[model samples]
Target: MSLRFSLMGPVRAWRDEEEVGLGPRQQRAVLAALLLNNGIRLSNEQLIGMVWDEPTPSALMALRTYVYKIRKTLPELHLKSMDGGYTVRAEIVDDCRGEPLEGLRSAYFDAQRVRLGDYRLKVREDCLERELDVLELQKHVAAHPLRERPRALLMRALYLEGRQGEALDHFHRARALLNEELGLEPGPELREVHARILNGDLSAPRRPEQLLPDLVDFTGRAEEIAQALRTLPGTVGITGMRGSGKTALATRIGHLVKGRFPDGQIFVRGRDVAGELLRAVGVENPVGDRAALWREKARGKRFLVVVDDVQDAATVRDLATPGSAMILTSVRRMDELPGVTWLKTAGLAEREARDFFRKVLGPARVDAEPEQAGVLLERLSRLPGPIRVIGGRLSSRPHWTIGMVLQQMEREGKLAGVIPSDCVAMLAPLIAAEERLSDPERHMLMCFARQDAEVIDSQRAADLSGADPGEIEMVLESLAGVHLIEPLVLGRYRLPRFVRFYFRLRTPALTG
Candidate 1:
């Protein structure tokens, strides 16, 4: 028996050079999540959280069915049934960086220069300042001997810690040194940051991308967020659809409890996941056993690795050394990651989504036309990604009212609206899902497109598609795995409203 598993792109498997039949999209998500962390056992609760974005009454039963289907399809795969969860057998080929529950690849890294802001984060404190860090900032200034950004940062750090006299004194010294050296004034941004510090705006916000944004009106996921904090020093997986605030939640938790991780907080994105972590901890150009070297270096260091926009779980698993805590955010469900807690982010509740709108548009703006606003939220699918994009557009234009926006939504239709209700953005994921389907599965989905009902069972599907009942059952299951169709209890299939609209929009000629 030969078996190959890919966690990259969409979760798929090959046995004997032929693609093995997989279950529904959620099930595929489960499979992908499992394959990524091949040796780790995931409990039923963990699997349920990663697979389903929302709480389902039948999640436990559904998980059982999905596992059984996977076993039946890939009998050669070593899918183990643990005491409380499940595990799958597959070798982790380290290469590629697709998001969670996708594909795998080995990590290669390159060195980078650490900025003052980044360095400062490694040794930051809230109420007090570390004297050695102050000296290190000074040492960087001495090395530059002419730059003002580092000097300005040093001043700000001192000022926040109630060293007003020393901060001003340092600023004056930096100003004099600059005049004597390059005959230049500090850059506008540096000057502004210094000014803000001088004005006692210590509580002023930093860049939105600076570690974590201040989520003052942070709306949902109280339980999951809390559990994530509690499970620190261990791995916590945050998986959701794109723009579901997976990264935001991870950043927030990283910042809130950073006191526990005194070593530092490493926020990684772009190339070289392992390389980036090594740089943060003072290692350069590792030549062997990257995992072992990383474990040695990170030993006794309480750094928090917040891996945003994760493309593959192999990167996370490889980076999860015996040392250090990790939090992974992905747009796909992740499974089989050993010793990792799972948190699946869904669309906000009605109340939270509405409240989020109020905060974004201001209470007066949304409250004035509450009914229309409520309807508008539903149209946006209550996903944070859409809400923030559209809300940001509206907030920037004060003259435009919520009612005006709603009218525009009706006129252009939610999916057709360019900025706020972008059909292309909403359809991208569905398109990707469709691309992963087999020829028969694609044909079956085409048949689904021709139907009127939003749901169809295996028997009804065969009737409408003119395919054999047994064949249709397998086809529907395949389509459901990529989320083109939803698999229900007793072999029923349901489609989301947006999905229904998209199918109807597809020309019959194209489907035929």
Candidate 2:
């Protein structure tokens, strides 16, 4: 004889069309627990934990009694004890016609009721998807305004019915309700639906391939590239002063490893990193509670996300995924971000910078004026940004010699004019970094810059700034943390030449 069990309503069982007596409520709870894990073993402790909120000293004996009663009542259940646990072989039915475990009072049973209730609603949603029952979905959303799946289904139904405006309005209301109630915005699913209705794009979300074009004149960083590639499917944080070619190095690595991640390769450069990442992976206009949806999209996928010009650790935490890799470029080291392989970039080596100029200006042009080129490279501090700008200017004006270019740069008293129009934003990162400093920090930096020495120790810093030597050391360490200054042997520090120049130009009074 077969047994039919129902927990969707009051716990009951029928054996071959005859209703079986299931004894007391606690006994019924044991029977329900067994039925839930029909083919699995349930230890005495496991059974008690699932059936009672607080088990008494006699609960173990009580549980054993319940098992005996259940076996005697339903002989066909084949309940047997083995391996210090009980296992039952019985068929369980999911009948969702009524409330699950109705009339049950134990806390354990109440939690199961909620879980099964959610399962029932999910089944109903599966049915409604085929039926397109807008009214039913609306009621579900009204009752559980926080449930994103039901609301998304409603949005889709409304869009299919040509009620675009209504769908949009419903989304706005859902957003407002979620924000007001839970202090969260809607997740990716709802936002995607809203974007689709607004753009009339009912197609599947697009997988973004937004990596910026790799530098054609990309040069050097062979070791850095190898190190980054070795850390595949993990995070690599590249930190340096502004215009140190951090972005270029990260971009080069991104392109080199693009073939490994079949899911996609995404690039994020602006303030809206989370939203940009979501949209790149097909969640358009990702709103409230984006982290969960972003993780969902990233799970079980091999992708590459290159976040450029990051200012903080929190910006890329959600971008980390189990099966993907990330390359983050920032002006400051993100020490707070966990599990990152850090590489600090600096001005290119003389050999690499010369090779870069050769690639941009042609070997003949660079070779024709090797001496002048060396001098120009020295004057520019061999930083790739300025070198590239000068290379472009000379490339465009072939009549201009490296000597003439150097004279022009000298006459201008700054390389600001030689910088191409497009590359002018290079200073923005430095300015922003400077603006983030505290008054004390800025004042200390200016005082250090005003000193005549090329390198300063804590004593020099304290004497110049009139602060304690210990306190000045801490400030120097803080400055080094942001890559504004470089720490050397014997407690000495040297600010980068370009950074010194920048501070001198910005604060003329600090200059000699």
Candidate 3:
């Protein structure tokens, strides 16, 4: 029988048009909140606040009580605890239209819903909730930042993914996190385990990085790609979070627009564009003035040069010559550069991100667990870097299911190094730049990292940092100007998830 839940009416639950007992009003409200905001994670704090308009210290206890009652009422409901929060399955379709004026799921839940549908949402047949039952749990993990289980899980998960380097790096972070948060070294339990892993005593299966993830289904960036193509013969700066595919986009453009350039195309990281271009044109070390020589050689030629991960404006300043067209990719827009077209890259649409998973993991396998795949996408924030990394890891081990990967990720809290080095390197330069800000500005930025809310206005920032309300606006704008923070509508500001994590890592130091 089809299940129906209503928020517009008296918060009722029904099976095949017949009302199912949701226990009581409070219990029904909990179910209503969960199913209504499916796919989006709600922290325990948030769920407690949502279930009851005002909550006391016992709110969590009350929330759990209702969760149990609701589950007893309907065993089919899919509620999951993931990524330090809770998520509901999108399959629980929404028919309720209350104060928000909703026609589609996208209209109501913009933060969570990536694809649109009629009245019904989608879930998988095997996308069961709570795969790890309380009885099956041998040990209990707590919320302390230095908890051994969380760090161990992420390290183990990374090692299993054949990323031993990342697993080792995450251990250092956990150690530092413990010292920073609790002012103590890792407990004896954690230290002994670390010793074994460090000594190569832990069993780890390593795979070479030979498997190049092919992207047959490139998506969600057609307009940006076209903009890159159209603004040729000049520097087109592609700015995005680490995994938003700036390098991949540049590579794709180089392939597509190769014919336009008669001489050749060269990609470089630093001021070494001169050498790369010289090598591409098959010219062995010119006599004098490499910059002038490059310009003279490219004088009339429509050569293409792509500079990836440009940290500062000076890198482009050196490559700024008339001969060849330049394509620059970086975390910042590099807006100071003359004649530069800025293309800000955002994460792929939910549907596009899911399609990307299928492309890597194979359609049949992905379709076998579409709902879990969707959750996995949400967990990875739909970034190409993590998506590719996790997808390729699964490809290496075909026996691994989507549910298992997701469970591990959820347990790890973004998994310190589950993805490639791209995640680690993306913020290094920006973080260096952030160091130049005043103490107040640095503290204000740290406030964003510490909080869960993304959109913070001047008033909120002022309150968080205990600074003047007037000063908060100017500071936020300054951060935005440097591309360290993002400005949203209505004077709100947001820090990207990774950016927030980076600052949070430095938060202990920032305050100290």
Candidate 4:
């Protein structure tokens, strides 16, 4: 059987069809350093130096002890005493490879730099086969075997090779992968290369490229924006509560449309009160001749621009122009920016909410009883944020069961805050008819509108609502059935921001 050690996440060893555990920290330490220093034999001193940040007494002995344990655990490993130190045989180290093909591609590009003619020709061939940018080739290079520098080179080569589609794809992937692996992103060199390639303005001679900001995660609304993008030279707006992923969708669309535009792509934040166009391009107070720069650099550029978190109409108006496609996302809709398509986003559907809960609550815990899944979803009103919070709490409290969660919610007086009409109007339910709340429940719902507050555990709810534990539990269950208020955790609940705002006005009599 073959032997291989995996170092992608945690370090572990395995023989063909068998598992080998990495027993101790020291063993893990030794294995980690060797993986980092692949193809290089580290002397005892060198290995010790890499492992510890602080100085230690008897470092040699610690190193030897770790090596002994590793070999003992995996008798199949071929460790040799060579050139006055220890070395792992090629076959043993081979199994510990990280990203194989990515490395080969990077090396391929490095060889291209010296022989530009041959490199360009090969890049052309790649473009034909994959329709990928030469610059993108660098990304696949950086992904595994090769390092960051070569990856940047591949991005440049692809852009130079006139493979815009592939080039932009590389930048997007590199940005994501680098962020995940290193918690950072590619430098300005790549961003500028990416920008030029997308705007179809990558000059024959690569000019100076500007630095780009880190990309944000685009969840939930990817499909919505993708559909809107099909109609070019159009406008799309994302509307939701604060922190509800509006800006994320717009930014992702910007990244997506980069290839479609060849003249230029502009990214601006609505908060930039200065009204300076250069700030949108990622520069602060861009100096020298200002008017000349704006006219020469920006005029008549066919680009895709994303203006984020638009709160003020006047500010949005100043940023608008005739050319270039625009995508905007705002907490509240604005009529100032006219002649643009609008897309409204709300809470996730039942299935989406269920999937999100399963992700947070763990498949085993959620899937154990199917009936409990329906109970949890119905109680939460299928709102993603509240569901996530509740799911997260349940996941963390492994000892707590679904019944306990529900019962706790009951005793806290968190029930019956929503009437049937509240849900039908908000969620756009499948049924043509809407449900209404009973007068007693309506009175209780009015109580919530009087105070805009967070729903704590059940004990707190009982104290606030002046309702007995059993009565509160019964009301909450009834309300949840019609999607009035959503159960947060065992005694807590949350109303959507808009829902809260709506009730606030209705509660004027109580407040007055």
Candidate 5:
């Protein structure tokens, strides 16, 4: 009997005018395996092994189900079970010429449609991260030579994964093998994939800087940070003193390698926590609406987000993309966030300090001679903010040279305030603010803001706040929202220098 089959889009089997149905996955697997092999008697074990790829006690029963389905549909065809093997005894002939192997082919190919979509949508990502462990099993099964469709599907997935090199390599190898062994080129669909990879285009958007961070003038420290970032394998935390250039360095580091992120950078100030709290309570816009802004910035593509004066670890984690790079700045230590790379920014070394002073001071001297540069450098920590402020002051009053400015600074005691606006009046405002605290919460803010080091200890802070540890936790969290303080590590807090100073110097009248 010449059996007729139509196997495009959906698989259909027929003999003369009668139709046959293959009902279930295992049944389809059995029939398709037999069709692929053709005329061969497959032992029960071989059929079960091919169909399920694993041990099953009901394997024979499942095979019986497939055989029964096929038998019921093609009652005229003879199927014999003998010698513990199954054989299709039907004499299927050519349609006077080219026979129809189309039905079984369609069934087998249709099985792959959803699998291909799942591999593309549910598994692939451009972050070079293995996010879906469940797909790992699929990857192994799809790599086999006999599974051309699945293999091609997997390759297309990898191509969309931003691993252009690996994807292209697999595609080429598959193409070569398909042509050499099967005498067939990859279908037009896969051919289009080859074209796309060659053109460096894939459905998954590329992350421009996965391998390295963009380097900037940071010199030794910046390069060291970048190298640490590449090797460290996770997020980085940056800490420094006021005018120590933490924000500047963090911003520079992010900018240097912004292209690497491809996701753009996020900048949020530490002091904006109040705004964040107010927004959270629906009282006012979150400080600069940074949380909402961050969400917006992070909406579509990946990003390298920097939260300056990072007081909120929860906020940081919320804003962070799982595999993306982020640089956070704090006046305090942030040891709480996991997988954070911490880089400390101290004031410049003496030589760099001298250069900074001179950069602002210039070649010619005003009142004091050029040699008096050393005197000014020793008095100042060589911090850029202070150097610029002092230089700008002296340079403005051309009548005074370095010596005279130093002399007047020494006499008037205005040298401290002479620091740039960004880093002016450090300790006094903090101390006076401590005096004005009516509640332990306010005092806690004062203590955290005046942290001598770059980070604060929150648990110890609870002890200092004189509130229950839980209350301290709540207040600390609240202060963090207002950007008054930031978490350097769990239970520790760091205060921004400018705010600390502002509190100490400005009396209630000035502050109110």
Candidate 6:
């Protein structure tokens, strides 16, 4: 009862390792058609079509005669008749030993031959994807350029091997070839792989697990962290003054909720955020736009996405999906985002700042000069960025005491100078924020710095800058939007201490 059949190469059958004679070529064609459509009934007309390129007047009789012979040859095959059609039960093994129905020549068998050939190719490609044999897949793709699955496999293999550029180039070539030859575009498989490559997404058909490393010495933002966590599976926006640790808080929350999102924990920043996000989830690249593709990929996925340092709400407007959660960190409040729970970050409390210093500089050093530490923290306005910079500097220079550090701060007389040369990179964010200001914004910022008052109302700003009060309010709101200045009660605003110090040092003439 153990019967095995193969149509991959010469049509053949075996019973308990013994080869069975399947009659002559024409008869074998009938048997081959029957075996290929195993468990499916084939009428007389169907059998005639498969067996003959051109059926003669006696074709039906010949088919009946072939059927009888096949039954006699392999009686165990149980070829039966029902509803005026024949059906068979056989286990067809994919033993690709030779061409299907080798030596069987009949123009009528051409379509069947082509169909079986495609099936064999699919078997080979399945093996290639599992094996990830790049070299063999290359050859396979070259032989069958229109095969999207193998090409996608090839692209993924190339990307995983760090040959991203080459993989991307291969996609472009394939796309062009697909369009040129067939007057069509690449299928979803190819486009997805291409999108992953463009977005630098290596994990496609696999969940993306990515997040920035959590700060080992991360400090403060307890209430903010709690509020962020409470939002759960919903979008949360964390905004604050520059250097208030928005990114750090978001990173911390990403780590905290890592277990909740089994699909992924993705962190994305920089200009191509949409592309990066699509790449993270392994979405296929679309032909013209990514929004639809991104939505498709994000839908019904349990994942966490941390979009850091977002400058504009529009950039990530469509990033949220139904089943996933997202955290966005920005310098200013993004009220434009719908249903977003906002958490505004501020400078760490005195205790948290001390703890941060202890973690960075060691308790021994911090405890040694409590007074100097407090003064230094006061000078830095308890902002995490400056504290981290000064702590890192002091940690390395064990010989320098907190008093000496404070003296250095006084001597330098500017936020930029307080940071050591090697640690000057920490100030890049602050500098970049200032540099992004428009000409009028920058001039208005200088005007704000010129006034002796700590907090300036629109009227005061108008009086100082000689601009209209309405225009000054717009400019002040714009400045507040970027976190360069903090809006206070009663339509007043105060420049952050660090911003004031930075502008004072850079443009001393304006302050004078």
Q: List RMSD in Å for every model shown.
A: 19.9, 16.8, 30.9, 22.4, 21.8, 20.6
Query: Which lDDT value does model 6 have at 494?
Result: 79
Off by over 4 Å in 5: 1-233, 270-301, 366-371, 414-512
Per-model tally of clashing residue pairs: 20, 1, 1, 17, 42, 3
What TM-score does prediction 3 earn? 0.49
Candidate maximizing TM-score: 6
Residue 290 in model 1: shift from native, Å?
2.4
In terms of TM-score, which candidate is stronger, 1 or 4?
1
Model 5, position 199, has a per-residue lDDT of 79
Clashes, model 3: 1
lDDT by residue for model 2 over 376-398, one digit each (tens)? 88756677877787788788898
lDDT by residue for model 3 over 1-512, one digit each (tens)?
A: 33545544345566544677766666665665677675678888877766555578887888877776766777756566676567765233233233221222222243323332222221110011112222222122233344565456556555555667877786788788878887887777567656766777665322111112335666667788766755665678888755677788877766665654544566677656566666555556766666667676665445678888877786456656553568888876776788798888766888889888888778998999989988777655677766777787788888989998766544443443233253344344445566577777777767777674566688878877777877888888877765556778757877666455556656655566
Model 4: worst 10 consecutive residues (lDDT sum): 96-105
Q: How would you encode candidate 4's per-residue C-alpha lDDT over 1-512 as one tens digit per residue? A: 33555443355666544677877665676765665455578888777766665538987788888888877876655665567567663222222123221221223323423454333333333332233354355444744521454455566566667666666777788788888888887887777777767677664521112213434322355457655664335577776544344555666666655654554566667465323456544445667755355445444444466667665766555444434566777655665577666776656666665666677787788778668776766655555555556676687789988777667544432333333342333333222112245644554555665576545244655566788977777766555433455677765666544344334444554345
Error of 3 at 469 (Å): 5.1
Model 3, residue 40: C-alpha shift (Å): 54
- Candidate 6 residue-wise lDDT, 241-349, digit = tens: 7778888899998888776666678888876677888887655464546766787776645679889988777788987886578999888788888979999877789
TM-score sort, best first: 6, 2, 1, 3, 5, 4
In angstroms, the error of model 2 at 86 is 38
lDDT of 4: 0.55
Better of 2 and 4 by TM-score: 2
What is the C-alpha local distance difference test score of each model?
0.64, 0.77, 0.62, 0.55, 0.54, 0.78
Off by over 4 Å in 3: 1-217, 279-289, 318-323, 397-399, 414-446, 468-475, 478-485, 497-512
| lDDT score, candidate 5, position 130 | 24
